[model samples]
Target: MLSAAATPAQLSAQAASGEAGLERSERAAEEQQADNIIVTGRAQKLYRVETTASTKLPTEPLLSSQNVSVITSELIQDQGARDAQDIYRNISGVSFFSYAGVTARGFRQEEIFFDGLRGDPYAGFSVPQLFNLDRVEFLKGPSGMLYGPGAPGGLFNYVTKKPQDKPFSADVRGIVGNADRIGGSAEVNSSLGGGFAARGGLFYEDRGLFRFNAASRTLIADGGVSWSPGPVTVILQATRYDQELDASRLRGVPTDDDGNFLADRRWNHNEPGDFLNLRSDVLQARIEAEPLPGLTLDATMRYNDATEVQNYHEPRGLFDSDGDGIRDATIREFRDQRRDEESWSFGGNAVYAFDLGGDVGNRVLAGFDHFNGEEIFAGRSLRGRNRVVAGLPSPLSLLDPVYGQSDPATYNQGPFSIFNTDSRRTGFYLLNELTVGPVIITGGIRQDNFHDDSDGIVFEDEATTYRGGIVYRVTDEISLFGHYATSFEPQDPSVQNPLAGGPFAPTAGDIFEGGIKTALMGGRIQSSLSAYQIRRRNILQVDPRGDVGNDGVDDFVAFGEVTSKGIEFDLAADITPDWVLTVAYAHNDTKITGDNGGGGILNRVGDRFANAPKHQLGIWTRYQIPDIGIAAAFGGDYVSEQVSLSGQPVRPFMIFDTSLIYEVGPIRAMLRVDNLFDKTYAVSGFIDRTGHFPGEPRSIFLEVGYAF
Candidate 1:
C-alpha cells in the first residue's frame, strides 16, 4: 500500500471539490492524503483508470467510444443506488419508462457483464440485488463490436467487486419505509490461502407500493473468489436471485377520461392482472494472464437459466364480437402462464502494448475479441373449467378477490398457447488504439453472424461494422474528441412472408458524435458536454392489436427512416470536503424523417418511439460530518412526457429521495426515504384505460451495519 504523502496538486483538487466549506475541504484533503490511492480516482498499475462517466474521460480512454458511463462502487454506495434501474434513471438521455416491468430495458433486455466476462442475458433481468459489484459500465451505443447483439439503446456491464487484501471487513444494514416495506443487506470480505481471497454479499427486500394493488419480495446472494499464481490470475463468481410480485391492473375498460386508465372489470374484479413469480441462477469464470511484460490475455465464459410463472384471467366476452355474457360466449376467468429461458456466452481477447522507437513519445496498443450467445424462450397458457355470470352468486370472485373469479370454463378446459420463440447469435471483432504525444486515435472492425432458428424455421445472415475516434488534449484542463459508429439490428422472428414466403430482412443505423471533456478545480470538479446525431433505416414497426398478425401469421416489413439529434451534459464535483454533488441533463429531438405509415407500411413511423423521453434530468448530493459521525444524501430525477407505442402521450413525472447515516465505533446506521415527495408517477402503464402501472410511492428504510 502507498503512504499518505499527497502532492500539492492533489491537495488543491480536493480543496476545490469541497468548495462548499473551507474547513471541511481542507480536512477532507488531509484524510485523502492519508489514504493514498483511495481519492485519486485512479486505479493502481494493476489496471488502467477509467472515468466512470462519459462526461469525464481519464487519460487512457476506451477507443472509438461515442459515450460511456461508469458507475463506480464508491458512487453507488454514497448515493445508495439500489439497482440497475436506479443507475439508468439517474443518468441523462435515459428514463425508467416502466423499468418496473420484467420486459423493460434495465430489467430484461439490457446487455450486461460481470468482471470482464460475458453473462447470460436471460438471467440479467432477474438480478434484483447488486451485491459484490465493483462498477457498472454503460457503453452508450451498439456494442456489437465487443459484446454481441442487443438493443440499439446501449449496453451495461457489471464489474463484480473483488476481494481486497486488507484482512477482513463486514457491513450490515436494515431499511424500512413506505407500503410496509423492510429490507437489509450484508457483505463480507476475507482472505483464504496462498494468493487467494474471497468475498460474499447477500440482500433481501420486501415492499408494497402505491398502486391499485402491488407488492414485491426479493432475495439475492452473490460470491466470488480470486486466485493469483505466478503471472496469471483467475476469478470465479456465482449469484442466485428469487422474486415474487403481485402485479395488479385493469386490462380492458382500460381507459379513463383524458385517455387515462381507470380499471379493467373484464375478469369480474376491479383489478385483474396476475402474479409474477421468478427464480434465476447464474455462474461465470474468467482468466487473465501476462505472457510477456507488455502483453496480456483475457478469456471468459458464463451461463444463466431462469423460470417464470404468471397467473391471470382472460375474459372472452370482452373481445369476442358475438358478445354473449353466458356459457355460449363465455371465456375462462383464470389463466396460468409459464416461461423458461436459458442463455450462454463465451469470449476471449488479447491486448499488446509497445513503445514507438523515438522521441515522438508514441505507443501502439492492439487487441482482438470473439463472442457467441444462445437463447431459448418458451411460454404456455392454461385456462380453468368453470364459469360465473356478472350477477351470479359464486365464491370464486370472493375467494380470490384480485382475479374475482377462478372457476374453470366448461369448453376451453386444458390450455391454449399464445406465443413462443428461440434465438442464437455469434459475434467477433478486432480493435486497435494508437497514442502519440497528447493525441490518441482508435479504430475497430466487427462482424456479427446472427441466426434465428425458431421451431423448425431458420433465419440467418451476417453484417460487418466499423468505428473510429480521435481525442486531443488541448491542455491539462481540457480535452476534445469526435467519434463515429454504426449498428445493425436484424428483423424479429415475428416477421411474416408478405410475398414469396420469406421473412423480412434486417435493418441498420449509424451514429455520429462530438464532445468536450474538462477537469477543473484540480480534478476535483469534472464536466462534459456532447452532441450526437443518429439515423436509422429499414426500421420495423408492429401492427395494431399489439401483434403482427399476417392473417393469423405474424407480419413485418421494413419501414422508412428515423433521425434523432441530441445534446447531453454531465457534471460532478466535491462541493466541500464533506459534500459531493452530481448533475446530468439531456435534450433530444427524435422524428420519422421518412416513412410509409400512410400506406400502413409502418405502425411506429411518425409516432414517437415508446419510452423515449424528450428531456431527462437528475441530481444527487452527499455530505459527511466525520467528527459527528453523521452523513446525509439527497437525490432525485425528473422526466418529460413520453410517447407510447400507439402515438399516445404518457404523462411526465418526477421523484425525490433522501437518506441519513450515523456511525458509532464499528457500527453504522442508516435511514432512507424513497419517493420523498410522494410524487404520483407511473413508471410504466397505458393511458385512456390502457391499464396504468403506478410507480413506487413514498417509502422509508432503516438499516444497521458493522465494518470490521
Candidate 2:
C-alpha cells in the first residue's frame, strides 16, 4: 500500500475489503445488510470499495488519477440484474452498441479483463455470466500502459469470488417470471481448517425474451481453493461456462423512416433451428508472499479454452422488385460460423514500500506479463472470415414472414480455411508513487511487443505508453487530482488495402483529465466531479474509393481521427444509515475531426459516432426499515438521442425500475419490475441497415433465497 493521506473513499471502504475487512464485516452484518440483500454479510465490499484491482501499488480510488466506476455484487443483487446489459443503466456514459458490445466514453469497446488478465474468456458475441463474479470495474481512458493493446475508451475488469477463510456459509436462490423465466443457483464457501478454504457455485437459467422466437439458456460451474500458511498464500480455481442463444442474432424489427415498426414489435426473421452457442473452460493459479516486512511478491497463471458456434440469419434489406414506393419483401442470408480459441497467460509483479525519510515514503512496482493465443475459425459463407466458398440468399416477406425457407446444407462448404491465426504479446511495466507531506506524484510506463501470424504471414510490432499524474490533499475531506495518459492498439492485418491506407499506422489515443473528490455532510456523502478530452488517431473508416465490386457496401479504410470530450459527476451517499443513494450524470460530445479522404458523406469530418448519446443520467436509491424486515429500491436511466451509422435518428428514452424486498431471518425475497411504464423504445437505433433494435417493453421477476 502506498503511503498517502486518508480520503473519503478510503474512509467509506476501509472496513469492507480483503482480510482486514472480513474481520470487521463479521461483526457488522446488520449494518452492511442494508445494501446486501442476502442478509449474510459477504466479505467483499458492496456499495463502496476502497481500492482498484491492481497488481502493483494499492491506492485509494478517490486519490488515484485514473477514473474508475464500480458495480459491486450487492448492487447487482439488489437490482435483480440478470446479465451484463441489465447493469449498464447503473453506470454513466455507457450504452448498447451490439451483442455484448458497449459504447463507452464515445468509443465502441469490445475487449475486457477477467481478474487481472487482459483477455476475455468468452467469444466476442457471447454474453458474460454474472453469477460467479464478485464485481465489475470500469476503468476509463487509455490503459495500454498497464494492460496491453486495446481501445482508448477503456475496458471492464471483472473480479471473481474467492474462497473465504470463515465459518461455513451457503446460499440458494430460485427465480420465476412471466416471460418463461425460471432460474436457480446454489453457492457454498467454508473453511477446511489448517489454513485451507474452498468455494463453489452452480447456476442455471432458461429465460425468454420479449421478442418472439428469441430466448437464452445459460449454465455455469465454478470452484476454487486456497491455502494460507505463515506469510505465503496459494490459490487454484477452475470455471466452466455454457450458453445458447436460440433463434439468435435477432437484430431488430423492420422499421420505417419514422422509427415505426413496419412489422410487429416481437417480429423475428430467424427460424427455430437458428442458434448461437458458446462453451468456455478456464483454469487459474496464483501465489502471493510477503517475505519481508515491506516487500511483496505475487505470481499468477491462466489457461483458457473456448468454442463458439453461430447459425443465424442476416437481413439483406426490404425491396419492391417492381420499384414501388412501398416495400413488402425482404432478402435474408444464412450464416454459419464456428471457432475454437485457446490462450495461456503468465504474470508476476513485485512491490517494495520504503521511506525516503521521516514523513516521506515511496512505493515502486515492477512487473512482466506474457500471453500466447491461438484461434481456429470456420465459416460456410465467404462473407464471414472465409478464404473461399460462397453461400446463397433467401427471401422473406416483411408483412407475413415465413420460416424454414433456408438451409445451411445447401451452401457450398468446400475449400474453407479453418486454421485462422496465432498471436502473442509480452509486456514489461513499472510504476512509482512518491508521497511527500500532503502531495503525491505517480508515473507508469509499459513496453508491449506483439507478434501475429495469419496463415504463415507474420508481423511483429512494439509500442510503449506512458502515464503521469498528481494528487494533492487539500484537506481530510477533499482531494484534487489530474493526469495525462497515452495508449496504443494494433490494427487488423487483413485490412491492408492501399486505397484505405492499408498497412497504416496503429491506432493511438491520449487523454488529459482532472477531477476533484469531496466528502460532504459529515463524511456521509462522497462525490467526484471530473472532465476529460480524449482523442483517437488512425481510426478505421470508409475508403474514399467507390466499391470496386459494386457490392453496394463501401470499403473500409484507416485514415480517420476522432475526439471525445466529456464532463461527468458521480455521487454516492449513506443518508441516515437506513437509506443509500447513488447518482451519475455525463455529457459527452464525440466528433470525427480528421479525415484524409472521404466519399458519400460517410466517415466524413464532423460526423458523430453512431449510437453514442450526448447526455446520460442514472439514479438508484435503496432504503430499509430494520424494524420490519422490509426494504424498497427505485432507480431509473435516461439517455439522449443519437445518430445511427446509416444517418438515421435514434430517439431518446428513459426507463424506471423498482424492487420490493422482504427479509426475515435467513430467508429473503424480492420482486423486481423493469420498465415500469411499458414505454415503446429502441435499445439501439438503426443498429443495422434495415432495422432498429427494440427495447424490452415491461418485465417482472420474483426471487427467493435462503442464506446461513
Candidate 3:
C-alpha cells in the first residue's frame, strides 16, 4: 500500500546507512593530508567542498542552499567504481532507471552536462568511462534557473581531468575480475615550458557479463592542454570513445503471472548475433581572463558527435494461450535501430566582486548560453517475423534450458525509415550574492527560448525561471539555509495530443527546500539534513473521452499534477586517526495529486510513482593500519519496496560490498567484492509484467596500479 509519509523505522534505517560512508571518506582525506600523502590529483576530501564551478560561480556547498554530492576520484578508485551507476550508492535519493537513465526524487533525469556545458543526448545514454574524469557532481532539485530546460529531478555534471603544471607524473593500472572482465588504463601528466602543461589518458576494457552471450569491448582516449599566458588562461580538451556490446541489457528477463521471475538469474534470451555499437567524439575549449582587478571573464565552447547502432532479438515474455498451469511457448521480438546525433554549445560568463563598505561584500555574475542539436533515427520492428518457439512443453523447467536455437538473420529484414529532429536553445541568466556578517543572500533569474522540429512539425516555447536562497551561519561550525526555485521543461515535438492536433505545452515545476549543515570535530565530521517539496504541473494524461485513431494513436491532455516531497540526511566523519565512515539516507514520497477523468500517464491519481523507492540508505566505513600498509572497507546499500507503473510491487532488497587494499611505495593493490551475499533482486523494470531487470550476482575484482 502507498502512504503519504514514511514510517519511523524506514526513516531511521536510511539515516543510519547514510552516515557511515560520509564519515569514512571525510576521515580518510584528513588523515592523508596530515601525513603529507598525495593521492589521485590533490587528496580528495569530502568534509568540505569549498567551491563548485558548476553552479555558474564558485560557491561553497553550505552557502549554496542546495543539496550537492561530490564523488571524488579517490572515492572512485577506492570503491572500484567504473560508471555513473556504480557511484550512486554513496548518494541518497538516486537510482538507475537503466544503464543510461537516472531517476531522482521520482522523476527521470534526461539532461546531463559535461564541464558545465550541455551534453549530447545520445552520448549521455551510453555508459561513460570514468578513467579520464576528475570528479562527478550531482546537483539535486530543479536547476533550470542556472542551466537551461531540464527535468525537475536535477542533473549530473562530469568534470574532466585538467592538465597539471608540475613535475612529470604517470600512472598505469590493470584490472581483472569475474565474468571475464579484463581492462587496463594509462595516464600521463607533465608540464611543458612557458606555463604550458598537458595530460593524456588511454583506457581499454573487454568484459563478459553474468548472462550468456553478453559482452562488451570498449576503447577510450582523452587528452587536454592548458596554457597560462600572463593573466589569461586557455584549455583545450578532446576525447574519443568507441564501444561494442554483444547485446543490450535493456531487454530484461520475463516474469510469471504471480510476478515471480521465471528465468535463472544468469539467463539471457537474446540471440548470439545481437549487438550494439556506439562511437562518440567530443571537443571542448575554455578561456578565462582577468582583464581588470576584481573581475573575471570566462568562455567555453563544446562540440559533440555520436552514433549508435543496435540490432537485437528482444524477449517478450511467456504466454499460456490454453490457460494451462505450465508455460506454452516463448515470445520474441526483433529490432534494427540506428541513431546519430551532432550537437554544439557556446557559453560565457562574467563575474565582478566589490566591497559594500563596513564588512559587507557583494559579487555579481551574468552568463549566456546557446546550443544546437540535430539527430536522425532509423528503426524497424520485425513484427511480421515474430517467433514463438513451440514444442517446448515447459520452458520453465530448472533441470535443462534451451537457448540460441533461433536464427536472428531470418528476422533481420528491414526497410529503415529515417526520422529527423532538430533542437535549439538560448538562455541568459543573472545572479548576485551578498554577504553581511554571518548572513549570505543569493538570487538568480533566467530566461530561455527553446525550439524543436521533428518530422516537419515545429514547436517553439519560452520560459522564465528564478531562484532565491538565504544562508545564515549560526556558528562557525553550523549553517542554516532555505531556497526556492522554479523550472520548465518543453515537451518533445513528436509527442502530441491527437484531440488538440498539436504538441502539448511545457511542464512547469516549483520547489521549496530548507536545510541545516554542520562541521564538527575540527572539520573531521560534516553533516547535513534537508527537507524539500516539489510540485510539477501540466503533466500529460490520456483522455478517455477522446476518440482513438485507426493508427493506434491515443489522445492526451495536459491536466495532470505530481508532487514529490522528501527529507535527506547525510553524515561524514573521521572518527579517529585511522577510522573513517560515511552514511546517507533519503525518504521520498511521490504521487500524482491530480489527473484527468482518466488515469495519469502511467497510473491513476494518488498512486506512487514507479521505480521511486520511498526509503534509500547507504553506509561505507574504512580503516587503515599504517604500520602494515593495509586498508579495509565495508559497505551496504538498502532500497525499500517500489511499485511498478502498472501497480505491481517490487520487493525490497539490501546488498553488501567490501574491499581490501594494500600499498607499498609506488605499487598499490585492491580486491573488491560486490553483492557479497549474492542476493537476487531487480533494480528496475518496464511498466508491464513482461520484463524485470535483475541485479548482478556476486562478483570479484582485483586491481593493481603503479604510480611514478
Candidate 4:
C-alpha cells in the first residue's frame, strides 16, 4: 500500500526517478540493445487530452476558453452507464427535467446532435444506445456560433464509432440484472483489404421497471464502411433503432398537501394495455480530402426517418368528491396518438492553416449547412372518465387499488386532433484562431435563416450571432481564458400574441464566462474552475386579459426575461499508478428577472425556474490491484431540492453506486450496483399537481464478455 500522506508532486517525482533509473540501467548494458525493451503502463483518469466538439478544431482542453466535459468509453464501461443521464452525474449543473428532457444552466435543453448533425427533439424518448458510440461530449454555454439556433444552456454530441484499420477483432457481451432485465451486444471490426475497412455492432435489451406493468424492449444495429484509396477518404454508415414500452412511463406517485409522498413508490396508475412504440432509420455519408499540404476539406450528409405510436390510459389526479379534504377517488384519462417524422441535413467545411512570422500560427474554417424536417401528428383523448369497472364506483379508491381491471376500449373517444409542422433552416459560419507567443485568440460568426409552417400558418425569421474568446497561457501547464457569446432559439409555431398581431419572435440569449485550467503531475491530472452568467430575453408570457383557460390564438405575449448564473469546479487525476479520482461540483442560481403584466402564475419576476436545482456534486474513485487483475470503484451523486413550476417543493436526495471488475487475457467480468441505499425520491414532476416521477430502487447487474 502507498502512503496516504504523499503529495501529488512527491508521487510524480518518484515515478520520474523510477523511469530515470530504468533508462540508466538500459544504457549501461553492453550486450543488449536499450531500445529493444519497452514498458507499457495504464491509468484510470477519465479526462481526455484533446477534443474538437467545442471549437470544431483539435485543441487541448487546457487551452480552450469554454467549459467542456468529455465522457470516455472506459469510464462509461466502468460505471455501467446505460443512458446519457447516467453519464451526466460526473458533469455539474446538468440535470433531468424528464426522461426525454434535460436542463442545463437553469434552461431546458431539447436539442441533441449526432456527429455534429441535428436530431429530432423527441429522439430523447428512445434513449440512445451507447454500444456503437465512441464518446459523449458536452459543450457548455451559448453555442449558436457553431450549431446555429439552439438553447443557450448547452448541447450534447454523440460521436459514433468509425471503422479502423486493424486486424479482425470481435467482442460479445451479456448482462442480467434485477427487475427481470436482460441484455446482450456484439461488435466486430476488421480490414477488408485494398484500402477498405468495415465495422458493425448490434445491441438488444429487455428492461423491466420498478413500477408495476411498466417495461421496455430495445434493439439497435449500426454498420459503417470506410475506403481510403488515395489522399481522399470516404465513409458510409447506416443504423436502425426500435423501442417498445408498455406505457408512456410518465405517471408518478402523488404527494399530499404537506409535500409528502402518499403512495407506495412501486405503485403505477397506468393501464396495463397502454403502449408506446418508436422506430427510426438513419443513413449517412462523409468524405474528407487534403488537396494541399495545409488545406483540408470535409463534407457530410445524413437522412433520418422515425415513427412513434402510443396508446395510454393515465391517472390525472386524486379528487375529493364530497368537498372534504381527504381524497377518496382517482380520475383517469385516455390518449391514442401517432406521429411520423423525417429529417435531412447536409453540411461541409474547409480549413486552411498558415504561419505568420516567428511563433505565430493561424487557422480558419468556413462552413455552410442546411436542414429540413417535418412531423405529422394525429391524436384523440377522453378526459374525466371513470375506471373500467362499472357500477362499483365512479372513480377507483385511492387507498385500495386493483390493477388490470380497466378496459381502454370502453372509453368514449373525443374529437380527433391532427396537425402537421414543417421546418427548414440554413446557416453559414466562419471561425478563425490565431496563436501568438503564449496567447490564443478565437472568433466566430454565424447567420441563420429559419422558416416554419404549421397548419397553414407560416413564420419566418433570421438572426446573426457571434463569439469571441482569448486564452492566455501562464505556463506550459496552466492557462486562463474568457469568452463572450450570443445565441437564439425560435419560439414554437403555435405560440402567438394579439398585442404583436403576429407570431412570437425568437428568444435571444447572451453569456459571459471566465475560467482557469491546469494540467499537473506530468499530464496525470487535469482540472478546471469556471464561472458564468447567462440571460435570455423575449420569453413568452400569458396574457392577463385573455381567456386564461381557453386555447385562443392570442393568449400569450412575448415579453419576459430570465437570468442564470453559476460556478463550477471539476477535476480528474491519477493520484498514483493504482489510484484514480474524479470530482465535480456546481452552484447555480436562476430567476425570472423581467415579466410583463401578463405574467402567469409561475412566471413571477423573482421566482426560480422549475426543476432547476441550486447545487449539485459528484465524486468517483477507483483502486486497482494489478497482481490479481481486479479493480473496484465507488461513486455518489448529490442534488439539492427542486421545485415545480407552481413552486411545489420536491425534496433533495443522494444516491451511491459501486462496481467491481476482473480482467484476464481475453475475458472480462463486471458487477455493478446502483442506488445502493434504496433511497426513495422524485426524479421529476408535473405542475398540474398530478404526481412526481419516482427514482429507481436498488438494483444489481452482472456482465461477462469475451474478445477474440
Winner by lDDT between candidate 2 and candidate 1:
2
Error of 1 at 309 (Å): 2.0
Look at candidate 2 and tell me the lDDT of residue 79. 72
**TM per prediction:** 0.81, 0.90, 0.91, 0.91
RMSD of 2: 5.4
Over the stretch 253-293, how does candidate 1's per-residue lDDT look in tens digits? 23333335333222232223456677878788878798898
Clashes of 2: 0
> What RMSD, rounded to one decimal, does every model reach?
7.2, 5.4, 5.6, 5.4
Model 4 lDDT tens row, 1-708? 000111111111111225654663454353222332111112212335344554576566666777677676766776777766677666677877776567788888867888788765245455666777788777888888888898888888777888987899999999999889899999999999998999999999898888777899888888999999888899999998888888564566777644466777877666667788889898989998999988989888989999988887666667775678877567776678888889998888888999999999998989988899988999987665444444221254556657656566666676779999999989999989999988999999999999988887788989999999999988766788899999998887866433334577888998999988776655566667789999988887666666654554446767878889999877667776667777778889988778786565232323777778899888877787755668787888888988765566778888887888887667788898888888888866655445667888889999998988
Model 4 spans > 4 angstroms off:
1-46, 121-124, 321-324, 386-398, 497-500, 545-555, 601-606
lDDT of candidate 3 over 1-708, digit per residue (tens): 000011111111111114664774565565553332333211124323456666777766656676677776766777788876787666677876766677788887756788888865346547776788888777788888888788887778888898988889999999999888999999999999898999999999989987667898989899999999999989999999898888663555665534466777666656567788899999999999999988999999999999999877655545554567655445556678888999999999999999999979999999999999988999887532223443211122222345555555555455888999999999999999999988999999999999998987888879999999998877666788899998988876877533354577789988999988766554556777889999888977666766455445667677878899999888776676667777888899888877776775543324777778889888877777766668888888888887655556666888888889887677789998899989898876655524567888898989999999
Residue 596 in model 1: shift from native, Å? 2.1
TM-score of 2: 0.90
Clashes of each: 34, 0, 22, 0
Candidate 1 total steric clashes: 34
Window of ten residues with lowest summed lDDT in model 4: 1-10
Candidate lDDT scores, in order, read: 0.57, 0.75, 0.74, 0.74
lDDT of 2 by residue, 551-662 (tens): 6655776676788999887777766567777778888998777776553322222367778889988777777776678888787778898766665667788888788999
